[model samples]
Target: MADAPTDITLHQKSKILEVVFEDGATYNLPLEYLRVYSPSAEVRGHGGPMQLVTGKKDVGVEQIDPVGNYAIQLHFDDGHNTGIFSWDTLRELGENYEANWADYLKRLEDAGATREKLWH
Candidate 1:
């Protein structure tokens, strides 16, 4: 069984979600990170390659809806609410934050994408 979240708090000013688990684990996840790494099919891709989501540095979670007993549905200010974040997924994201963020930055660099820069 996975460690259930004991407390979940959203820091709107900082755009961070603080999650404390029953196993004495705590994670402060950035909203942008969660948005980009969303488990939704649109971001994860069906069976091809994972899509590189850009221009979400200012995205924030407007609401968090509980999904049964295992996951959460994050409603983003950018109108993205498709991802259902499970407890395991949240834990994994928190655990691998550093490496995953670094990898994301590298991918963005490779794709000539910027978290802030947008060109029309």
Candidate 2:
């Protein structure tokens, strides 16, 4: 069976998604992190290299809708609501948060990018 979260809370002020798994593990995922690493084809790419999503340091999740019993669809404040985050995916993100975050930062640096939202 896939790992399931026991509870999920969205702390809007802090822009953090708190996920508590059935196994007693809890992950506090920042909205920016979630947005940049969204599993949607737009970010993950369609059978190609994953896209480097920048300028989302201030992104926030506006809502979360369940997808049956296995996953959830996250509605981001920036109007991105396509990524369906599965239980396994969330678990993996929680488990590898540090490494993943570090890798993301390195990738951004290598590309001469910044997380700061660019003004129009």
Candidate 3:
């Protein structure tokens, strides 16, 4: 519910994105984490069951660029980066990381997916 980001920086080596908001809130999001949790319909789908994104444990961020003033474009090293994460959405992701991660873990477990295979 805070303001949008004013600046965004990507640390490619560390595979992390640092976003600074106008309200002074900042977030450091990992590439692997972001890839697995992309907001794209290809990842989330339009309705019904959500597509479980696997094999993203070791995916690195290839590029990070601003999309005007509303969102950011992320390119993954694995050649799977068509998702544009919006500022508000990014903030929500940062704020709900723990809960969302837990849910994702549960979903993965239910889908018989493992992070080990994702990295390999």
Best by lDDT: 1
Cα lDDT tens digits, model 3, 1-100, are: 4466887788877878888887788888877778888888888788866678876777787677778877888888878777889877899888888888
**Per-candidate TM-score against the hidden true structure:** 0.96, 0.97, 0.86
lDDT of 1 by residue, 29-50 (tens): 9999999999999999999899
lDDT of 1: 0.94
- Check candidate 1 and list the clashing pairs: none
TM accuracy, model 1: 0.96
lDDT of each: 0.94, 0.93, 0.80
Stretches > 4 Å off in candidate 3: 117-120
Q: Model 2 off-target regions past 4 Å?
A: none
On a 0 to 100 scale, what is the lDDT of residue 14 in model 1?
99
**lDDT, ranked from best to worst:** 1, 2, 3
